[model samples]
Target: MTEAEYIKEAKKGSSAAQKWLFDELSGRMLMVCRRYVRNEQDAEELMLDGFCKFYSSLSGLQYQGSAALFSWVKRIMINECLMFLRKKHTFVIVSEHVAETLALQEDILDNLSAAEIFNLVIQLPAGYRTVFNLYVIEGMNHGEIAALLGISEGTSKSQLSKAKSLLQKMLLQQNIEYGKRKTQQ
Candidate 1:
């Protein structure tokens, strides 16, 4: 069935349509959850929470277009995932000096694939990871990230800049090691 028909059935509370919708969207949504969360179990839980919210809100869905529906649902999923991460990870700002120094660093994310970037991001400390995800991935400005994380804007900017520098260094090191191994072989 087309997406419109499926949405109609889903909004009407058809279990089969809901099951189909969950099965169809779970894989893609899981990838989004995984970007913010490190553990597979936690990602799975976040994905379920997103789907539950999506299904609960289905009655309010008016299909402007297929893309719009997907985008709307994706935002809901991202918010749910962020909320889940917030519960698991706490953010603590260090000092004004540290935050200032962090902002002076340059970003180094130009050449990395999505998976590689996400892997490096997940390795960051909780504060840095959350700031990076909100600022870089979610496309929020530093002020927005600060408000969401309950820190100063300077701290958000600092954390994001630090996250970028660390990611760049890690990627560079990985490249150098890979090149060395290739030469040795």
Candidate 2:
């Protein structure tokens, strides 16, 4: 079925449609949730919350096209995750120069697996991690991130930079640790 048909059926409150929609979208939405939430359980909860909000808004959705509908819903999910993070008082404020330095370190990330990257993210200080996820992963502009977290744009940029630096440092440390293990073996 076409995406429009699926969305239409879901809007009409069909359980099967809902199930299909959830199944289809949950993976990408969960990644959004995970970006803002540190804990697996909390991420799951936020993912459900995003889906619920998406379903509730479905009736009101004016789809210009399939892409537009999906994009709108994805934005809703991202906003939900951010709001959930906000409720927990997890927003971080940092500087723009720091974000740039971190951005330059992106090349270091190419060697890491997704699991390694996630572990590195978790190791970041709260502020850096939040901004990094918002700016780098979610593609939110500094102004939007600052507005969402109630911080200045400079802070958002800096936090992302710091997050990148920290992630690079952590990965480097991990590489060294692996090298030591191999030498010892």
Best by lDDT: 1
lDDT of 1 by residue, 1-185 (tens): 98888889999999998888887788878877777777788888888988999999899888898778777877887788767766765565666567534332244565667777778888887677777888777788988877776788887777777776666677778889999999999
Clashes of each: 0, 5
Stretches > 4 Å off in candidate 2: 62-70, 94-103
Off by over 4 Å in 1: 100-110
Model 1 lDDT at residue 124? 81
Candidate 2, clashing residue pairs? 94-155, 95-158, 96-158, 98-161, 99-161
lDDT, residue 173, candidate 2: 84
Alpha-carbon TM-score of each model against the true structure: 0.86, 0.84
Q: What is the C-alpha RMSD of each candidate to the true structure, in Å?
A: 2.5, 2.8
RMSD of 1: 2.5
Candidate lDDT (C-alpha), each:
0.77, 0.76
